[model samples]
Target: MIRDDHQAGPTLTSPRSNGARISLAHGGGGQLTDELIGGLVLPRLGNGLLNELLDSAVLPLDAQHRLALTIDAYVVTPWRFAGGDIGRLAVSGTVNDLSVAGAKPLGLALSMILAEGLPQRDLDVVLASVAQASSEAGVPVVTGDTKVVGHGQADGIYLITAGVGVVPTDRRLHPDSIKAGDALIINGPIGEHGLTVMLAREMPEIDSVLRSDVAPLNHLINRVMTRHGGGVHFMRDATRSGLAGLAADLAKQSGRHITLDEAVIPVRPEARHAADMLGLDPLEVANEGKVVIVADRNQADQIVATMREHELGKQACVIGWVGDDGDGICELNTLIGGRRIIQKPYGEQLPRIC
Candidate 1:
């Protein structure tokens, strides 16, 4: 545990950088990954409208205000991981992406790629899982396409999904508004999805049943938008590129810095132990069901309580706060009282773990 700085709020001590790189760890959905996206990728292609990091982008209309859109692909190895399958993953990934953008998912456009010799029953199982996940996620599969390849041409299966949602005029979200001194919150434990899939792929000898965190976070989004004034500054699913990569993106867009207390950062003991054995930092691991939010401290308590009201946020915490570091840097104030720059992840640590 880190010494409490809940009072002084640790000062930002990280060096600032603009370069960002993609790494295997970037795919883990932890802190390193967040930095990569936050620092590098988003600055080049996105604007304020694209920065909210919500499940889907919410557009305020002078008159038109009914549709939201997002597209995503899943090429996760071991198509069938502990918690979900490719089909379900494809659907939920798209749905959550749209959801985080401040949209309520309504329909999906799906596509699948398969290899020869793959069992039809396995495909059936995956499709069934997709249907079930869509139901649970409150979205529908409205259309799709499929393709097949020879035995060596494909890696079992790949899937892509496009989703559309409706945005209410009342809900307004933007990432640029993510000001200094804002509170940073996580909806649940981090790294579970990435680690679970890794456990299945690399260490099946370990008896623990790890599951993917591939569920839609729309309902949770609904609860938040309905309860709060939708004063949310930013929102993002901890996906390809972990929390670090995502935070880096936040820092870049808002033109400020973020200081996270290592102790307050939440990670399950099981995940921590597994990551230790694998020489992985839970911060850079991937997660599907989790989200990172930057909002006002006054609203942090209410947001956390609303999150806990849902099944996903029982471990929700105000892990850190946005600060006036002013150079787009993110720092981790160690439990031992040291501070370090959160560099972009380098090589692949857990490839295909997503």
Candidate 2:
């Protein structure tokens, strides 16, 4: 049975080990990522606003308003993928960051880094995707700049996107507000995007029709936040480190144990098969179009039903719940009736994975 009470319990082990030097795992959005940020980044550059590490920072714009600001850099290799291009990924990624923070995206600033000798046709395709994504998200790219670098100095194309969104005065979404007993919700299947990209590069011989699950989620998120408002405590877009990394980070930040059931967490059959073939855990792979919601159990049923009504959330499910078992630890209840710690990746599993 699910329990909703918050009580102090045993101290669970942290995801990070005593290590030095930055590695790809540090950027994989797991324990190592946390150590890099908490251990080094925070002590030096953290302020009241930056320390929280929310996808978007809520800045007080005036006595009556707050603005959410976030920025991201995209360097996905190949520039083009099965479901999206670099341009679309850049737009959708930034827009989702703002939306997850309970913001209504207003505008975006884009900057492009073009490598010398890159084909103009490739740039055109990426730009077209950016335009389509921006239009669909209802957030305009109001400003941008472009630069060219020496050949081989960079990938064919790189993009930097910064977004601004408005958060309603009455709503607040942050990990600090998440309490034990809140249900953990996932919008849809995980690992499709990461696996699709990996397969394109690593095992092109294994051909399948799988495509990246990359899309803008602002409309889907806006529905839930507007309807449930205060009942929704925290939300995050599962990106670089997939769901496993997200759970680990949430546990660490909220000082609560997040227990997930393997049987209930949704994964597409093809995605699971691909992950298995690669010796990867689907939960630890990356995603481009997924969101994790922490909300009151009382509101979870309604939330899941509402999510199903949206195309992006049609596969939404209640994956887990927060509890007071091991402080700042994340665990998974295995299908075989055992428990395992879900830790952040130590090094990059798939480099340039957006």
Candidate 3:
């Protein structure tokens, strides 16, 4: 649906929009494209850096320091769903990457690939949601581009966001810092975000109420960083591939095998119910606003406490520890006293997940 002004993404696809479905005109730089950007994109995402609208952004760089940058592309199916939509998911995904790396998010550059026959109103709604997410994250949409493809040349729409952030002072967080005794801490419940989309789209027959944990973790990260910056060995958000991949990466790269407690790992009741019905491994699903943190054993409790203070981290727990297995794999200690090897998922269980 089209509107004189841009509305949020979820609002765009509702029956009330003045325009139905999108068209090539929305991507053209003329009036329709102008409406798409001005009416929708700008209002939600515009800020000091973005409003400049120059070919490039000029900024002063700090001396003797490196910057952290991350880019994420959102192609989640059914763009709008329970909890969060693609627009907000894209923003949060990019920002969370920076946050887990001990960085303060600075700005985002958005690119939209529009399929022909898509509605102008739909573009407006999507852009507006992107804008709102960036605004909430305190990041500006500094620059962007739009391209239209042939009908069926693309899925409904695709969004790409590149983000930059500043790392903390005197922080040496890296996989190398993880020691054999460091505790593995998760910053929230395991499977909400992954199951939310799966159930929303009726994928894989997982049928309980669930939603994606798409949110900004900057504040939670900051709180934990404040108390344990030096003690933090590493941080990573579990996304398209969840904890197993993250755990395995830390295991191989840091030369520390990871051990996780099955019973202690947090999972929501809805997700648990759904997982039982579908015979799915929740660890294989995606999460937009969660992190796997490595902290010194002495500081693990403190880190968990700091995280729980933030709403995003209410279920934070130390579910594992660094161990000495040479295989560099993430091993789970099941509730039934059995051990299983956790590896990166072989293929896409759910595609189009940001």
Which order, best to worst by lDDT?
A: 2, 1, 3
| Candidate 1 weakest lDDT stretch, 10 residues | 1-10
Model 2: weakest 10-residue lDDT segment is 1-10
Candidate with best TM-score: 2
Candidate order (TM-score)? 2, 1, 3
Off by over 4 Å in 1: 1-66
- Tell me the tens digit of each residue's lDDT in model 3 across 249-307: 56755666889898998888888887676577877667788888899899999999988
**Superposed Cα RMSD, model 1:** 7.5
The 0-to-1 C-alpha lDDT of every candidate, in the order given, reads 0.75, 0.86, 0.73
- Which pairs of residues have clashing backbones in candidate 2? 24-348, 25-346, 25-347, 25-348, 30-344, 31-344
lDDT of 2 by residue, 1-354 (tens): 112121111112342454455666666665566666766665567666776677899988876668999999998876787899889999999999999999999999999999999999989999999999999999999999999999989978999999999988777887778788999999998999999988888888888777898899999999998788778998999998789989987887787899999999998899989998888899889899999999999999999999999999999999999996658899999999999999877668887889
How far in Å is the alpha carbon of 223 misplaced in model 2?
Answer: 0.6
Instruction: Estimate, for each residue in 9-119, the C-alpha lDDT of model 1 and write its tens digit.
Output: 212223145333345655544445445555554556546544444446555545646577788778888888778878877887788888776777889998989899899
Better of 1 and 3 by TM-score: 1
